[model samples]
Target: MTHEDVWRAIERFATEHGMSCSGLAKCSGLDPTTFNKSKRWSKEGQPRWPSTNSISKILSSTGASIQDFTKFIEPHGTERQ
Candidate 1:
């Protein structure tokens, strides 16, 4: 998925889970700014890719499986055949 798409998914997921970006980061054992919009943008104006470990932690904290997160990352109708 595109970086913007990924971020949007993450943001939506966080909201659905009743967690703010900082709350998600705390739940994931990351710095409060880990999921911050500012951190999502790099100095070069590129999107900072999230690490697998962080994603795993986020999933764990949200009590969500990888498959669920995958759906967020690539929602049903948005997927290509």
Candidate 2:
């Protein structure tokens, strides 16, 4: 999936859980702005990928599985890094 897709999935997941991305991050014991939209892009216009550890924490905090997150990737097709 594209970088954008991953972030969107995270956003969707947070919304589904009745929380904003900042809330999700806080619930995961991460910085409140960890998933902030401003952090999604770099000044150069490149997408900023979330670290694997962060993803894991998000999934654990939300009680979601990798499969659930991966599903978001399918709708957009796999992206060539």
Candidate 3:
């Protein structure tokens, strides 16, 4: 998936769970800013993808499968870098 697609998936996953990105991160035991919009990009304009550890934590904490998260990548146009 494209960088934007991946971010969008995370955003959708959060919304599906009735949480904001920051709230999801917090619930997953990560720093609240871990999924903030500002953290999705670097100062040089490159995309900053989410970490696998964070994804695993979120899935584990929320009882969502990888397939469930990947479904959100399907051209929904949510978040972006």
Give the Cα error of residue 59 in candidate 2, in Å.
Answer: 1.1
TM-scores for all candidates: the values are 0.82, 0.83, 0.89
Candidate 3 C-alpha lDDT tens digits along 1-81? 788888878888999999999999999999999998899999999999999999999999899999988878865445334
Query: 1 or 2, which is superior by TM-score?
Result: 2
> For candidate 3, what is the TM-score?
0.89
Give lDDT: candidate 3, residue 8.
79
Residue 5 C-alpha lDDT in model 2 = 86
The regions of model 1 sitting more than 4 angstroms off are 74-81
Each prediction's whole-model lDDT (CA): 0.80, 0.85, 0.89
Inter-residue clash pairs, candidate 1: none
Candidate 3 Cα lDDT to native: 0.89
Better of 1 and 2 by lDDT: 2
**Stretches > 4 Å off in candidate 3:** 76-81
